[model samples]
Structures are given as C-alpha cells and as structure tokens.
Target: MSAPGPSESGSTTRRGAAFADIRRRQQATRGRGRRTRSLFGMMRPYRGRIAILLVALLVATAASLAPAPLAAKAVDDGLSKGNLDHLTVLVAVLLGVSLVGLVATVVRDRLVGWLGARLLSDLRERIFRHLLQMPVSYHERQRAGVLVSRMTNDVDALQTMISSSLVTLISSVLMLLGSIVILISLDLKLALITFTTIPVLLLGSLAFRLASVDAFARTRETIGAITAHLQETLSGVRVIRSYGREQGHLDRFHELGDENRRANMKTVYLNAAYFPAVEYLSTAAIVIVLLVGGAEAIDGAVTIGVLIGFVTALDNFFGPITELSNVYTTFQSGMAALEKIGALLDQESTLTDPAHPRELPDPLRGELRFEHVTFGYGVPSRGGSASAGGTGASSSPIVLHDIDLTIPAGATVALVGSTGAGKSTLVKLAARFIDPSEGRVLLDGVDLRDLRQRELRSRMGIVPQEGFLFSGTVAENIAFGRDGATREDVERVVASLGAGDVLDQLPQGLDTEVGERGGSLSAGQRQLVAFARALIAGAPANGDGRLGGPSILLLDEATANVDLRTERRIEEALELLLSDRTAIVIAHRLSTIRSADLIAVVEHGRICEAGTHEELLVRGGAYAKLHEDWQRGTTDAPSAAAS
Candidate 1:
C-alpha cells in the first residue's frame, strides 16, 4: 500500500492535536474544580464563624429592605392622613433599621477581615514550607521569582476575594432575593415587568464572564512574568551595568510592563463596556417601572403610595445587579489566582523520608559513601538526548553516573575536577539535597534515604563558594546555625573557629549588619562568617567546650572566590575546623589541598583518578596533568566553579 500524502497526514495530525487540546482543557477544568473544593474544605474548620458571618449579612440585608416599606407607610398613612405622630414613628423606625444595618455591617466586616488575614497567613506559610521541602532539582528547574509570586501576588488576590469582594457578592445576592420577594408581594404585575429585564442582564453577564475568563488568567501570568524579570534584572544588575546594557535591560523591562498593561487593559476594556451597560439596563428597567406604575396609579388600579414603594423597591433589585458587575473583576482575578496557587500546592516533594526513619548514631562518624550512583536533573539518566544541560542529541547527559567513592571517618577528601565533572552533584547527594537516580549514598554505613533528612543533615556542615547570608546582623546569621544561640554562644563559636578577624573587621563587631545575603561584607568576610556558622551547628550538644559542630564538613570551592590573603586565613580556619571532622573539599587550587588524605580527580561525571596528592602526581594521569597545568597558572577547576 502507498503511504498517505502530506496533506492527508497534516489533516490527521491536526485532528489529533485538536482532540489533545480539548482533553487538556477538560483536565484543567476538573483540576480547578477539585482545587476549589479543597479550598472550601480548608475553610470548613471556620464554619462556625462563617455561620455567624452569614447571619449578620442576612440581618443587614433584611434591615436594608425595611427602609423602602417604611418610607411608603410614612407617605401613605402619615402624610395622607396628616398624622404627625405616625410620621414621627415611621421616621424613628427607619433610624432604628439604619442602626441595625450599621451594627450588622460592622460584625460582617470584622469576621471577613479576620478570616482573610488568617487564611492568607496559613497559605503563605504552606507555600513557603512546600518550596522548602522540594528537592534541589526542583529549585534548579524553576525561577525564584515565579515561586515568590505564588505567596505574594496569588495569595493577595485570594485575600481580597475573602476580605471584601466575596462579602459584597454575597450581600448583593441576598439583596436581589429579598427585593424581588417584596416587589412580588406588593404588586405582582410590576414585579413581573421588572423581571422581564432579567434575561438581558443575564445574557450580558454571560458574555462578560466568557470574554474575561482567559483575560484575567492572562493578567495573572503577565504579572508573574513582570515579577520574574524584575527579580532577574536586579540580581544581575551588576553584570548588566558592567556590560553597558542598562538601556537593554530597561527596554526589556518596558516590554514586560507593556505585556502586563495589555493584559490588565483587556479587563479594563471589558469592565468599561460591561458594567456601564449593566447600569444602563437597570436604569431602563427603573424608567419602565415608573412609567407603568404612574399609569396604573392614574387609572386607580394602584395608589401613589404603592407606586412610590414599587419605585423604591426597584432600586434594591437593580442596585444589586450593578454591584455584582462592579465586583466581577475581583472575583475573576481571585479565581485565576486560586488556580495557580492550587497547582503549586499540588506539587509534592519528590524526596520523601522513609515511613520509619533510622536515627543517626550519636557522635556520627561522618563516613560518606556513594555506590553506583547515577543522576540527572529533570532528564532521563539512562540514555536519550536531553535538550538541556548539554549532550549529543542521540545520547543521555547524566550529571553523575555509576560513581563509587568513600570518605573514611575524620579524613579530609578533596575533590579535584574540571567544570561539569559532577563535583557539586556528589556533594548534593551526600547532603541528600537531591537523591541519586540509580544507586545509594550512605552516611554512617546506612543508606541516606533510610534516615530523616533533617537528622541526616544535622550532622553535616555545608559551606558553598559564595557564602549566602540572611538580612540580619552577623550575630543573628551565626546564631542561625544553632537554636537559642545567644551572643555568648556566637562569640564562643567565632572564637573557637579563630575567626576574630571576621568580627574585628565588622563595624559593630558581632552585631554588624551583614545586609541582604551578606552583600555588605567582603567575599572573604562572608566566607569567614559562613565558616563560623558551620562550626556552631552541634555546639549545644557538646556543652560548648569544643566547637562540636557537624561531624562532616562539605566545602564546595569555598575558597575559590577569595584572594590569596583571605585564602590563607581561610586555610588556617579550616585547619582547626577539620580536626576530627570528615571533610569533603572541592578545591581549585592544588597547593591548598596538599595535605588532603585523599584526592579524587573527576572528569566528565566519572572519577578518573583517586589517591593522595603526591600519589596522583606520581601516577602522572589526569590529576597530574591538571596539577601541571595548575602550577603554570592555568587553573580550569575554578573557572566555572562546578556545575
């Protein structure tokens, strides 16, 4: 049989694509429904308060309904009969109704406000906790700003819905229901006449909902993009300015802003046309009521008092329709936000602790091992061309593969390798930040996966090349390493590490502000602070005599960013810190790690050579060649500083 022509295949492909799109949309709809249900389920715990809130809303709405009827009585009974006392009574009754409404409104607002605040706090905490629980690979694949927007913009939208717009929507609904019942009871004909305009309002609302659903979602996405771009730009502003690309970044920002403005303007355009159209329709309905009621009164079918009452009741009916339209934008924005937040909450941490985790041995030996470990970030490690992270199209690019290595207790093992040689990946595996796809990483002769992550990590101290610090004083940053670490503890930790230069150089000594991420401190200063922090980890458990820190110290090119002078000081600090601790150091300078007990030379995700520094030099293999090059001032290891 002959193969089908291109046009025929194209048509078939298009049909399949269309079907897939429809299925995806259906799945999304179901997911949104589930998320909405879950959201409501979360609120079930506050059901009692919600019940009270509903009662208050209903009472306020009922009180608002009383004014129109009272006015009618004042006109028909008091004025028509010229009874001054009756009019005064009606006026007083109206004032009392107003007071009731005011009180109900206060109660409803307070409850809604409290609920919104509590829920927002809970949701933000949940998102942050979830993000923290996620694997390192998950973070590697996501933009920081996008994750930040989940807690900020998304939660804010839902907060507004709960605090204000939702209350308005509910109260308006009650108003509509109450107004229609009163109108029908007083004069069925006029009620039916007003009800005739209902279909028109419904049709308009339906159109608006359909047109604005995607628009509101797009606005949420555009704002997220804006946030991501702003964050990225700020983070790399130094590079941009150095490259004289300030105008380029500004132009990019303007592009993002334009996209956000365009998305928002879509809703603005819809509201401009839709809400005003609603107002116009309600006005037309009121005019119709007045015209018909006036004629009925003139013909003596209805009294002027009834006519006035009907007109006043018409405001209650139409006003709600107008109010609902006003809040539609907020409702739509909130629902769109809910969809994004729900998706984030649905993301489960890929690495879960064992159901019954093994506890680390007291005074952990900190012996580390990687057995046949194979891993890749968000890609198949076995083999198949991955688009990202570099590889031949027909081959898989694994970050670490079939690796076996061991560090005996209290031994310093330095990892010497070129860029992308799986040096950092090994450290992450040891830390259980990301699990290996194929083999096992063990600490204290037990599989790392069998132990609780916090328990496993509590005994290991990791210091990256660039020391990251929080926005706080140096003492607080140091105290972050240990719970309840007082100023004395900080001083002791610092003194133990022999990093007096770190504090002595600071303007406020230990109390010096590090600024955001220690930006105010020099690179060397940050590293010193980081080392002190690492040394304080297990101090409390040891009665504060020895540093009693993590038994394992993982230093990933920790000295690569500093100058020779700082490196010497850091080396001096490490000499003291490394005593009786299993040290895994990823070093760029061969001279620094000369005393390392074991040196492993890694190349292209595999360990090509392992031995003492002098032994590797004697072998004259990959490590020897790297050492020769390094001695000649050609250090390739620190160029990129690991993957």
Candidate 2:
C-alpha cells in the first residue's frame, strides 16, 4: 500500500520517533529470561487451576473442529445426493457440538479470569510489601505516578495475557494441528498447495511482531509519562494558579497528550497492517487449494466429499493462524512489563539490619558521646571518584571535624547555627539515620552501631521541623506510635502537651479528620500533634519498667514556624518532657536557644563556640556577635540582662 497522506505522514514521523525511543529503552533492559521466568513462577501456586482451564480449552477446540467436518460431509452426501436422513443427522451433530463448545468456552473463560485476578492481587500485595520495606532514599528518587502506573497498567497487561492469551494460544495451536492432519488425509496434493503460503505467512508475522515490540513499549511509556505529568501538576495546582501558569501548564499537557496519541496511533497502524497481511496470505493459500483441488476433482483423482472436507478445513486453519498472531503481541507486551517489574524486585537494599545485633541493656541511661568523629556526607573526591560521604562531611567540606563531645544524662544541649552549619547532620548521627564515616557515636558508652537500630530508635522521640501526618483523625495522628491507646489515653497526652486548646479549636475536636499529609490542619497544629505523638510513644507502654520514657529528644526547627504564643506553650511543655531526657535542640532563632543549659554555635560545619547562655555572651566570639545581632533586631538598646 502507498504511504499515508501528508497529515498522516507527519503523525507517522512523530510515532516513529516515539517508537525508536521505546526500543532504545527496551534494548537497555537486562535479564529478559530471568524476568519472564520470575513472572511465570508467580503463577506456579495456581498451576492446578490453569491446567484445568487448558483442558477445557482443548475440549472446546476439538468440539469446534468436529462441526466443520460434519458439515462438509452433509454438503456432499445430503445436498449432492439428495439424502434427507443424512442431512438431519449431520445438522443435529453440528448443533450438539456447537452447544458443547459454547459451554466449554464459558467455563474456561471464567476460570482463567478468576485465576488472573487472584494472581494480580497477589502480585500487587507483594510489590506493596516490598515498597514498605524500602528505605526513604528509594521513595526520594521515584515518581508517585510512575510507581502507581506499574502497579495498575503493567499488572493489567499481564492480566490480559493470563486471562485470554494463555488459553487462546493453546487452543489455536491445537486447532491448527488438527486441521493440518485432517486436510492431508483428505487430499495430499491440495494440502501441499496450501502449505506453499506458510512461508509468506510466517515472514509477515515475524515482521509485525518485531515492529510491534517497539510500538507497544512506546505506548506503555507515553502512558506513564502522561500519568506522571498529571500527578505532578495536580499536586502543585495551587502554585500553578497563584503564578498564573494555568495556560502554560495546559499547553504542556496538550503536548504530552499529543505524544501519547501518536504512540497509540502507531500501535493501531501496526495492528491494522498485521491482520490484513495475514488474511491476504491465508487467502492466497485458499486460492491455491481451490485451483489444485478443482483439477483433481475433474480428473476423477478425488471425490467431491473429500474436496469439500479440504476446503472446510482450510477455513478452520486460518482462524487459529490469525488468533495466534494476536497472541504473539500480547505475549511480547507481558514479557516487557515483567522485565521492568523484576528489575525493581531484584534490587537489594543498601542499608539492612545487621546479623546478630547486640541487645540494649536494661534501664537505658541517655549518655550520648561523639568520640573524635570525622565524617563527610556523600561528596566527590578531588580525583572525581564518588564517595559515600558521612553525614558530617556530605553537605559541605565537613560539618563536624575531629569533634569530641559528651553530654551527661538528662542534660539539655542546644545547637545554634546559621544555614548550612550542619546542625541537622549532627542530630541525624545520634538518630543513626546515617553512620559516621570515621569514629563512633556512643549511646551510654556502647557503640551505637553495635545496638539494634529498632531498639535504639524506640527510646528516642523526635519533633521534626516539618511535622508530617497521615490521613486520619486528629486523635489517631497523635496516638500514631503507641498502639492500643484509649481515647482517655489520647486526651491525657494532648492535655499534658498543652495541645488540648488546639483540639477544642478544631471543628470536630479530636475526632476531626486530618486530610492527606495533614493538609487540613495549620502548621502549628501539625507540630503540636507530632509533639503529642512523640510524648505518648516515649511513655512506658505497659506499667512494667522494661520500656522507659524517651532518653533523648532531638528537635530540629521544632518551633520555627509556630506562633509566639504556641512557642511559649511548647516551651512550657518541653520543660516537663526534658526533665529526665537528654535533649538536643537545633534552632535558628537565638531566643529559643537562650535558656539552653549549653549552647554550641556552629559555623562552617564546626562548633566555633560553646558555653552556657550567659558565659557565651562573655566570651566575645561568634556566639557573642550572634547574641548582639539578636538584641539589636529585637530591641533598640542592649539590656544588661542580654549580657
């Protein structure tokens, strides 16, 4: 056929480019067989049901094939011979076969559909479980929309293969084999003539299969891209509207939509060409059969009944051939999806719990020590080699260098720093989010790494800068860490934290629903809720003394965003919470850190000065300068109390 018209030609060009990109990605995917095998292995648990479905398919194909031969016999013996009894018998048999085929098909389809849905559910659950186990870094790099698509679109593709393609492929093969054997038995010469077009049919199918792989891959990828774009745009819709970028975003969306449209059209074109080409080849086979059989019949080499049987079988053969070609496409799409999913499953976590981790001693005391700690955050070496820099040195040259510091149990240490001063990094080391590159973080004189991570973290309460909450009621958000807490338990924690007024202010009090990420609540409210959650979690679960209160409290910009009144209430609450806990508070506002027992002024990832709030003012150093700046910003005259 001639190439599509000019408008169509332009579309084809765009589609071709899209397909090329998809092909490049497919080529880059490693371990095709491993992925395919793993996907198949998932179905092994349901093998018995699959086998029953296959048996039903075979029976359906056989019953379907039976009617064709019976009709051919009726054509020659009843119509040509004018025999009524033979015609009636053959008609009845054909009707019975059709009924049997219908029943078998329905049973097979229902069974396979159930199997596919069950397998898909299992696969989704498995993936979700793995996702939960994955570290925070994995989520940091992945797009929400793309991950959602993998669970939905990719799994649905495999579902189609299992529900339809699996049975269809088996039945088609059986039907084709039955037709070929019967046709040759009826007339070898005509069968040979039909066989001549097999090579053409095979070549056309191979070409279509090869081209379709790229086309389908493009279609899948474009869908993911469009999904990701929509997710990102919708999440930031408020910003987009505020900045008057709606029209710009709409234009970009249209561009992505056009790309998706072109990809689908390409797949359509390939499918359109493939089916017609196969039909033409089948028609060619039929024409050859007719020419060779007609001559043989006239020369008295074959009977009319046998010739009719050959022609009838040819019709049956083409149906399976066409179906098989379609199944090939489904197989390829499923295989490609499996490969992507398997790669994700095969990835090993970079950080895992150690084997035989040391147990924590009873009645844990909060004596935190940093012993000659030198660390770098992930930084490139001068020679350009990539290094997993320790938390201390990762962000800049070194947040902490040769730092040896010890905090006595129940001491309040405040970390005061400007931006990029590594105050956050220092606290993260104590939390064990990342280990030190050199030296060690010791908790009660034991190496932090030697203790179980879960055991160590359980004794700590953190009020992060941005208080994150899940989709639930305000009460649930507060009681998140402690299990099986009663309503009274929740109310007590809220009252103690001075957040009871926050509950009363809400429309539904503690029962009010917090929208996703606590979007419904104000920033101050969210922070208070997080503080309540930490306090409740730190409290002993059972009256048994096994689990103690939080031995360490790490606050990073905890009150930075709260109002002055809320900050004061939080400070009052903190006085009670910090009485028996070792507290490390990271703050930018000098006012918040002024009452700290000891304040360390961090600059260039190092502590430039450290002393009590009053003594730091007397030192005439970085802390003194910062204190003077704070006084000037707050008051016209520096009061004696400030010194």
TM-score of each: 0.91, 0.84
lDDT of 1 by residue, 1-643 (tens): 9998999999999999999988987987898799789878878889999999999999999998987788778888999889999999999989999999999999998999998998888888878898888776677778888888877898999899878888999999999999999899779999999999999899999999989988999998988887888888888887998999999989988998999999999999999999888888888888888898899989999877778888898899989888899888998899899999998888766677889898888868888988899877654322232212222243545788699998999999999889889999888888888777677888888998799988777777788888789999998998888777778778877887667865787888888899877888988788878877877776463664656777888989888887676677778767877878899999888777988989998888998889998898899899999888887664454633431
Q: For model 2, how big is the CA root-mean-square deviation?
A: 7.3
Report the lDDT tens digits of candidate 2 across residue range 1-643: 9978999999999999999978976655547767767778988998988888878888898887886578668877888899999999999988888898999999888998898899889989988877765545456668887777778878888788777887788889999999988778777787787877788888987788778777777777777778888888888887999999999989988998999899878878888888888888888788877887888889988778787788888988888999998787787777666665666677544344567677766677788998877656544322232223222244545546767778888888998867887788788778876556567889988887777777888888888898899999999987785767667777877887888987789999999999988889998998998888777765564465223346788899999778777888888878876877798999866777777778988888677889999998888889888887876765763432353
Candidate 1, overall lDDT? 0.84
Worst 10 residues of 2 by lDDT: 383-392
Among all candidates shown, the one with the greatest lDDT: 1
- Which prediction has the highest TM-score against the true structure? 1
Which residue segments of model 1 deviate by more than 4 Å?
1-21, 73-78, 81-92, 379-396, 486-489, 492-496, 539-544, 634-643
**Residue 574 of candidate 2: its Cα lDDT?**
80
Q: How many backbone clashes does candidate 1 have?
A: 0
Q: Give me the displacement of residue 502 in model 1, in angstroms.
A: 5.3
